[model samples]
Target chain A: MAGKQQQRLPREVRERQMIDAAVRVFSQVGYHTASVEEIAGAAGISKPMVYIYLGSKERLFTACIHREADRVVETVRAAVHPDEPPELGLWSGLRVFFRFVADNRDSWTVLYQHARTQGEPFAKEVRAARNRVIAEITAMVVAGTRMPGGERIVSERDAEILARIAIGAADSLSDWLLEHPDESPDSLVDRVTDLALVGVERYNTGDLPPS
Target chain B: MAGKQQQRLPREVRERQMIDAAVRVFSQVGYHTASVEEIAGAAGISKPMVYIYLGSKERLFTACIHREADRVVETVRAAVHPDEPPELGLWSGLRVFFRFVADNRDSWTVLYQHARTQGEPFAKEVRAARNRVIAEITAMVVAGTRMPGGERIVSERDAEILARIAIGAADSLSDWLLEHPDESPDSLVDRVTDLALVGVERYNTGDLPPS
Candidate 1:
């Protein structure tokens, strides 16, 4: 019966289980501190099985990073509605990003901290993912600037800078949220979105009127 | 006379040499990748002497962090004249920060990336040093808002967020500059400060005019 039950689960299911276990271990102990034995134990399998399924530790880590980053990008992309104004789309995207991070803190840590330091290929993978998001943000800013009767304010170069600045603000706030785990993700998102949009609103407005 | 010829240098001089060596090693290889032997070798000293002088690798890291943080804070603080308006103060401080990162990229990387990841004590050390700089920024933001007779704009909480955003943007840009090494520090500072100040100025203006 045990052999039949093990056979019933597909290879994909087992692979996911291994990846989940790898993410948890990598996030908790970081890449170097984490070991194959611990990950296998966490996955409820033998070390040899992990090697067989994932090929190697480095491969396993790469797999985890790909999955986590894809999850984040998909969630953020799904939150944006094509018909919606750029501001609303961006706000929704930011909300999704915060909620994703809050729900999957471990996965986010694995992708951002662990993968970033594992050397070239993995770092490039993560950077490509980040750049994709940044590019989408740049597009949104460029679109948002074309409101009817509104003067063309920020140049493309400045718009790119604005997108990076927005991402930076959100990333920093997320880091702050990580330290203060007691804070609810909803309230944190509200504060972060407001602060971020306020900066955007400021950028759209060319001059500061005399107070 | 021959036996007494080998005299140890003064403690301060030796400490500086150790820190300089440490910054080079830590920034190059990261925390876990660097070894005490490498540090001592870089300093042209015996491993035993490094241990005797700086205690352990951990203590030596702490000392290096303190020294760099102090230099960063002092440089920014000295750049601004207190009598200048808050906006100018912030601009000058930003300029100083950019120049400092340009001149001492290694020191900045060691403090920001390597020390930040090692654990709580070192992270706290960096955070404390960072908050001191952030607090000064917060003060400037609060003061700048008061000039316009605007409705209590830029709250203490928002000011803190802004400070984090500003510093994070600078740090991310500095990291970006690592890849684009040909970019001049002055041009980078000019562009970033322009983006930041425009955001600040727009906030003081009551309405978010779509421009």
Candidate 2:
């Protein structure tokens, strides 16, 4: 019965378990210091099994990056509804993104901080993920530019620029979010919104007193 | 007479020449593929002398990163005048920054794109340079928040957030600038400013029609 139960698990399920363990181990020990044995042990599988399943440590790390990047993209996409306004969609996406990072700090560290500095293949993977996110956001921004009256006030180039700003701000702020553990993701969003409002008001009114 | 002239050159001048050559080589061939012998040849020095001056290829790359980072920071700082309003100061700094990256494409590639992905000692240097830039921009934002009436509309925290946005946007847009050779730095800045103006206009009037 036990042997049958072990054999019943699918390859996909086993791979998921291995990746989940790999992320935690990689995040904690880092890429160079982490070993396949430890990862296998964390996954409750044999070392040779890990090698057979993922091929090698490098490949395993790449898998982890892809999985985490997909999860983040999906999370942000899920939070944004097409029926909503672009700004609201952006706000929702940002909130969820912060929450995702906060909730999965280990994944964030491994996927972002570690993978980026690991060089070569891993850095390429990270760049690919970033480009994917950028493309999605650019599409959203373009869609937002068209008004209910069908008037497009913003150009496609401008939409791309705004999307860059939004993504960049979100990326930078996520680092800030991780550093400031006491701040909730929602609170950080509020702070950013408030600051933008104040900046807009100041810019328009030209009321900035000379310091 | 030639030997005497070469010997008369100061250590600082020799080191500078080596670094200038190293940046060119590193940027062209990357860190691993670049050879110290090649750098020495480019600098009009012997390979043995290159080793004696810069210790190793790693240290030579480090020197290149430092010098380039310093040049960028200095260029941006010089463009921003203390008497100018914060927005104008930011605009000037951004303009100079884009120009610098546009003007020094190889340096940008070596300092930013390459140094970041080369792993440890090099990655640390890149982070340090980034932190320095962030700190300077944060100070500028904080100063901007204080009005001539001595009233502060934005908090220090908010100021830091704005600085992050500025730096992140600049960093991301610089990549876009590099990718599109036809776009001038001035044109990019104008597009960004115009987008901000339109965004501000739309946000204030709540005139965004639901699509």
Candidate 3:
């Protein structure tokens, strides 16, 4: 009956099941201690089938990182509306990001904190993910700096700098968020929004240089 | 003659030489590729002596991390004066930190960029080092929030958030500094200081919440 059920499912569906189980096991026991047999058992499949689907434990972990990274980037991107003012877009994006992390603590742990320390291909994957997010943010910030007259308030370089600062602060605060489980994501957004408002106010006042 | 010099030197001096040589070799070839023989040869000592002095390759790397972490914390601490305003103190500390990374690129790479990805004891050491720096910044920020009339404007929690932002920005910017070799530490400091000033101005205007 199990074999019949497995044969009925497409390879993609089976692969997803394997990855889902892999993320749970990896997050619980961590990469070093997690076993392929355990993951296969959790997914209700044979060990050989698990290997056939994902190739190996290392590849399985990498797949988890890639999938989770995509989810995070997509979540933030979706939260931001291009028509809204840049500050509001940034605020909304941050709110969703924190919510995502809080909701998917397991995925977050596996994707970021664990994968980062695992070295090699995992670290490379994490860096690539981060660069993608930075690029998206750079675009948003650059767009925000433009005036109705087509004048640019912040230079491209400064815009990139701001994006880097925003991402760094977000990354650091995510770790803080994980540590303080009692604190809600909305409260964090409020605190950060309050802090960012000061700088945004200055930018609006022409305190920043023109590009 | 080498034997005679080895006998003449104290244990601490010999250990320092080994660590210095280890830092250079590790930075050049990375931790995995670095061999004790090369480090010993660079330090003009025997491989057996290297093991005797530092136990194993792992311990040697740990020692390098400890020494360099101390150097960074001390350099930044020395630059920050308690009597100065918090903003100036932060600026000066950041300046020295970038200078330290610029002057000792090898140390920074081995201590931060490398050790962080190596996992296990190395990652633990890196976290401990970061915590120490954060604590120092938090204290400075808390002090900065005090008014001349003995009133506090920012709450302790808010002060911690400020410190995290500052450190996260500094950490992220340091990577940017390394990537852009043409940019000087002072130039990076100037850009960051400009951004920080806007927020500081807001804080001065009583825009933030009072404790």
- In order of listing, the candidates' clash counts read 0, 2, 0
Best by lDDT: 2
Q: State the lDDT of candidate 3 residue by residue for A4-88, as single tens digits.
A: 8777687778888998999999999989899999999999999999988788999999999999999999999999998765555
Chain B of model 3: TM-score? 0.86
Off by over 4 Å in 1: A1-9, A24-47, A56-58, A81-89, A109-128, A139-159, A181-186, A189-211, B1-9, B21-48, B56-62, B80-88, B109-111, B114-128, B139-152, B193-211
Clashing pairs in 2: A209-B148, A210-B148
Task: List TM-score (chain A only) for every prediction.
Answer: 0.75, 0.90, 0.86
Give one digit per residue, the lDDT tens place, for model 1 in B181-205: 7777777666766655555544446
Native interface contacts kept by each candidate, as a fraction? 0.24, 0.53, 0.39
- After superposition, the stretches of candidate 3 with alpha carbons farther than 4 Å from their true spots are A1-9, A196-211, B1-9, B148-150, B195-211
Q: What Cα-based lDDT does every candidate model obtain?
A: 0.74, 0.85, 0.82
Instruction: Extract clashing residue pairs from model 1.
Output: none
**Candidate 2 lDDT, tens digit per residue, B128-157?**
888888888878877866888988877787
Q: What's the lDDT for residue A102 in model 1?
A: 85
Over 4 Å off in model 2, which ranges?
Answer: A1-9, A148-151, A207-211, B1-9, B148-151, B208-211
Q: Candidate 1: deviation at residue A118, Å?
A: 7.5
Please report the candidate that would top TM-score against the real structure: 2
Fnat, model 2, is 0.53
